[model samples]
Target: MIGRLNHVAIAVPDLNSAMAMYRETLGADVAEPFDQPEHGVTVVFITLPNTKIELIHPLGDDSPINNFLAKNPDGGIHHMCYEVGDIIAARDQLIANGARVLGNGEPKIGAHGKPVLFLHPKDFNGTLIELEQV
Candidate 1:
């Protein structure tokens, strides 16, 4: 069951500049940056009462986030992640509803080490939807 608003992912070309803007201009308290070697992203997190705001940049050549940023280049919402109590159930629902999972199966570790899985944008009215269980 999806539970909460996990976070909104924003892919930017420059991580430092994005973090600075979110902290200085938006008055959001930036958290310690971390690298998800698997996804090839270095991310900074900003916690809100419900959902968090994630600023992400590529850390390597094969970075998924890098490809996303390159394609979009707007540094806007990359995906909307909703916290789920049961990722399996949530994914099942999508599958039954004719949605395809981005990967083979199971949720993978996303930013902040949260377990997450993505529904293909093609299946979700062109919106990349993520379900995460923290």
Candidate 2:
């Protein structure tokens, strides 16, 4: 039902500045940015020892990240992701524990082809949590 942190998603106003800061300033070797049309986000990923970091900016107003950045202009933490052996099982368990699912009742392709889903932030003190199966 639980595992180590997989990645932390961070909302950014500009992808270029965020990439430079994470890659050059923090010295995190990041992969090239990718556009996720499904999520309406363009993201760059930086892998870490225990967890990865995702720098994301909304591609449009309808994008979820747009609303996130609107409320959190400083580009704060957006979501915390944990690795799961089976996303469906984990999701069911989480739901039984009163966690509300945000996306469709199914896993979606995420960064690096990982299966991912979002849990409603309201159920976790305004912290959106993601379950991912590698």
Model 2 RMSD in angstroms: 1.4
Measured on C-alpha atoms, candidate 1 has an lDDT of 0.82
- For candidate 1, the TM-score is 0.90
Q: Rate residue 109 of model 2 by lDDT.
A: 91
Task: Quote the positional error of residue 130 for candidate 2 in Å.
Answer: 0.6
Candidate 1 lDDT over residue span 32-53, tens digit each: 7898788888888898876788
Q: After aligning candidate 2 to the native by TM-score, how far in Å is the CA of 52 from where it should be? A: 0.9
Off by more than 4 A, model 1: none
* lDDT tens digits by residue: candidate 2, 1-134: 76888888888887888888888999998888888888888988888876789888887668987777878887888899988999888988988988899867789998768889888989989899988896
Question: TM-score of model 2 relative to the true fold?
Answer: 0.91
Q: Which candidate is the best by TM-score?
A: 2
* Residue 46 displacement (Å), model 1: 0.8
lDDT of 2 at 86: 90
lDDT of each: 0.82, 0.85
